[model samples]
Target: MQQAINKVELRNLQIEDYKELKNSMVEAYSELKEAYWQEEQIERLLEIFPEGQLVILVDGRVVGSALSLIVDNRKASATHTYEKITGNYTFSTHDPFGDVLYGIDVFIHPDYRGLRLGRRLYDARKEICEKLNLQSIIFAGRIPRYAEHAKEMTPKQYIEKVRAKEIHDPVLSFQLSNDFHVIKVMKNYLEGDVSSQEYAVLLEWNNIYYEKHQQLINTRKSVIRLGLIQWQMRPLNNLEALFEQAEFFIDAVSGYASDFAMFPELFIAPLMADYNHLSEADAIRELARYTDSIRKKFQEFAISYNINIITGSMPLLENGNLYNVGFLCKRDGTSEMYSKIHITPNEVFYWGMKGGSQIKTFDTDCGKIGIMICYDVEFPELSRLLADEGMDILFVPFLTDTQNGYTRVRNCAQARAIENECYVAIAGCVGNLPKVNNMDIQFAQAAVFTPSDFAFPTNGIKAEATPNTEMTLIVDVDVDLLKELHEHGSVRTMKDRRKDLYQIKKLKS
Candidate 1:
């Protein structure tokens, strides 16, 4: 009466293991008439992608197996039937350079079902997916229990019930618990899947680390560090004083290895102290004179400090009309300007500011980004347009006179992050400039926001500066999480848009 030796191992499937693998597959799917893979089919899978074919052994016996193949999703779409995906068991749809790893089969022997061997096989596939840098792991999961409820409800209804835990579907429940989300309910997916009534679900598990191009896999950054300046507004004696203060924050943020440093909108308004005697309109016009010098000095700081700088909003006097403009000074010596698209009534009355018509996202070493001034971020359409351009981050530089104004900017910015599925970093000026008429009595709380999901903070606020305080808030955010949310989040706002009913279009004016 000696106890049986217990041992477990997981590895790539060898050709000699085919017999045991087929036996395990048959025993696991005993309800199906044709449940085992042919010897030649297993050989072909090994020939095409040996690394993708995995098997788990318990005490020198094949107890579980998982089969997968790389596929060009464009050609073998998730909606394609099992026969088409597998080329009628010939596995001709397999493409070594494809972006998705398609799971064709996974089973654990009925004897080993309670041991969580199926989970091990699924986990192993995910590890292989990440190692190969595939965009995601996709599979047509069978809803075997659907047949029981098919007479009473549709496949979709059945799926919803299973998702809500109102129904217990062995396979679907297992997949849902493992972080695999059902993209859609696929019909007639497999011919002999009688228990599933020829129905299946297109399930996907996105690999957050996936890079579209293999060459840039190591070069592209996942985590981007942001440095936001809760700038204190005070009277400045001269242009040198403003530049010195700007350089001080830049030097400090760069020292902390921040990728981008953002200053609050109209941070240079304090320099208008010398023009306090002039009217509000005339004084801001005079402040616009330093736009060129500030641009040059910030660009210099960008290159010297090796950190990208967002110059906030400065008055630009162009063609006798004033506009609030900002500069994106890349550390590589390249610079781009974005003008405020939405002008506040106060800006029009006091400064006679005219809104700019153009809006676009800028490309930076860290990622593609869009800049919006105080009033601009409050408009949902503008940020949505930027998000359409694949913008990873939306930087909003604001100057608010009171808590009510800051609340508008803060709430809208947070909404943009959640709806657009992107990061929003907002910095604003605090303190007061009593000498400058329109710039007096500022209130702000600089903060960074992220898409609301399990991957991000519960409240969606990454970091925030103390209210109406002069401080720098530094936070690190992963751009990869946004990609995952776009494809496989709890609620995919981008993908679930009802485009047929209505659409958001940029009109050519």
Candidate 2:
């Protein structure tokens, strides 16, 4: 018997398997009053969606089968009856360009009931839904055992008991275990479902990777790769030396096909060595003079290396007032700027830096992203605002003078990732520049963080570099996982917010 079971294989339904398919369906539904599907009906299903009709065979004998069709969810209401969805078994409602996959039937022969054949067919249907980029899989699931408890409870109560594991329902329990949820309790869903007393539950399984628009060839990526440079601070003889060092790391990261490359905040502070003879405030203002030329150079590198470049944070002198700013250079030859919204006491006293008034997320080819400089990430309100704008990843380019400072930024960034249900990456400068005042020593540990859930790492850290080292941390994160967490995670922070009682509003600038 084990040897025979070893021959089990799944494939598309064929014409020659109709006889076994019909026999299996009759056997599986013997307790029900409905008749099995006819050969003509099976052929019509194949004509509509050939790949959706799946079968499992053991020792060349058909034992289980599943049938499905596509339908526009907007037209096929959740309250729709099975007959309406199937077009009275003619499948006239099947839409080739539909966003939802509708399950018609699934059955397994009694002889193969203990082999878990039905699960194989269900898994196959989910695979097809994701591959086709369907929004969800919807079906009217039967409560075959509901008649036993109909005298004492309602269908809703029965479903609740089944969900809580207090009751054992063959179909409902199995569906619940497979990550499907009841959308609604439907009545008169099937013509002769006597065991369920013509009652059924509408079930749905969402495809997390679903996108609104359909493309013959999808160019947008669901997984984005990141490269973070743990830069080392050192004196540079000229601006040309800085460009050469930047290109070396850019070329290395782009070689690995990274989508974005990030540098530490104030990474170009070494250039301040030329003006170190002046006061701290005077030298930083002089450092601001190089911002424009450096931004242009990074933009050229972004286009040449085919990677988005986050130019850390530089001194920006505007109208005689200094501001800490960062630039996002896209591979398409476009550039965007974000200013630090919060100023540290040290920055204010030494450089007389003023805070920027705006905070927003940036649109990138990979996805929506947010940038927060060293001190900006320490404040949760700024990140929460970006989260409202649908930020997928938060990049923190920091320059910490001590391990305590780095710890503050690290812990806060991790909290932002969990609270916002997004990814957070931190890159910072290490080593030292003794000649440059206020930049003498640095501490850093670059890391990528994810939401704490089953789909992510147990500790929530995707990858982290060695402490105070000059190296790159490369990691890939799936944006689809964020979609799942927003809707179905064990702890759904975004969905469970008490907006009725309190809300976070973005005030006008």
Candidate 3:
């Protein structure tokens, strides 16, 4: 039988708490008869990394404890025995520069079992992970009931059953519910462990919000180069001419060694040269017809130049309706698309396009990013939502016919960067589309924006091109700097946000 805690106190481990912690450890492991760390070894762990050690108390008496140590991931990722990893229970493997927080041990006093004290201790560990910006919490979990099924199943098969929910093991089941995923099974991980039969399951809980790795976090600052194109509008005499013009810009941008190249909204307008005589509505419908070919070409160019490309946006007809879509083609021949979420008045009334409902954040080789087209960037909620999902950069492809229209996008984009503490890049069409009605009058500029903080440019503008010009602006953006701004900026906007007063509600789909 277990008793509930009437009062509990949680804090860092002190030399005075060691005696009580050892007593609780002995009582908790009495049934399993596992080896326990001696008083001197436990004290050594506290000396090396006290921030990683915690103890829980009820009414001035220790009832539970959680021990952890930071270790260089390179060495931890290699195969090793328990003694070698833990430094004979002294946690000598501690590394200050490490990104991973390795769990040393966790146990609840027998009398406190089933009162959820263990859960509270685990939550404390997660808080530590966030505070220190650790990549993950890795530990080997014991399959406590393995000996019961050992005669009928191999250790692997036993784990498979546990994962399938066909059989429940005390340790692994509790770990899985706490967001830990199984990595692999280790053989001879522990000695004199009859309960687990000398086998352990490797588990990890990845910190999705962890600041990027050391190389990206260092002072040198790694940069992701961007090439923004302000495509010139000209009638395409033939399909071959369109491909040739597209290849020309691709070659030009590739020559600059850019990691990513982005085109302006409706960059495909010239491809509609043959159907210029059609009505505004009919011309957009005709433009939608090239969606397939344009997607294929976007992928082809992205692969050929070994660069990621955001192919502005094009009108597409889907299920008897129309949508404005942007395709992101990766250098690896893979691609993803995001539909315009907030349609402009001209888009709804003249172009006859519908706004998309869903929002998406993409995971790229460089970092996590998002795509918002034109009017979509004007809404603060959309960008905030993506920011909450770990988006570091936002790409906006826009088109505006007047100075006021361009200003609206430019201003709102800058606001989004400041509010969300993220980087925003805006590329817009800047020339005449004389043949296309509704889209003919173009006024725009291409600019890359950063958060308004000391770590970024004083003006928050990374790069900008002249308005109403046909040009491409290539700039190098340091993504790691975004991490610094989030944590140590003069004004920590993300951390200082008042969440208790109000929150943006996301409706159920």
Winning candidate number (TM-score): 2
Put down candidate 2 lDDT per residue, 183-209, tens digits, no spaces: 889999888888998899888898878
lDDT of 2: 0.92
Q: RMSD in Å for candidate 1, one decimal?
A: 5.0
Q: How should the candidates be ordered by lDDT, best one leading?
A: 2, 1, 3
Clashing pairs in 1: none
Best by lDDT: 2
Location of the lowest summed lDDT over 10 successive residues in candidate 1: 1-10
Off by over 4 Å in 2: 1-8, 57-63, 109-116, 144-169, 181-186, 214-218, 237-241, 318-321, 384-388, 415-421, 451-461, 480-509
lDDT of 3 by residue, 1-509 (tens): 33454678889998888778888988988865544677888778878888889989988899889999898776666667788889876577889879888887999887877778788888899889878989989888888899899999998899889888999897898998787888888988888778899898888887755767545432322588888888777778766787787778778888898878888788787767667788777888988888888889879999999888998899889898999998999988999988898888878887788988778798777778899998999888899889988898898988888999999999999998888888888988767777767767788898999998777889999989987888888888887688767755778777787999978756744
Give all candidates' CA lDDT scores. Answer: 0.91, 0.92, 0.84
Winner on lDDT (1 vs 3): 1
Positional deviation of 251 in candidate 3, in angstroms?
1.8
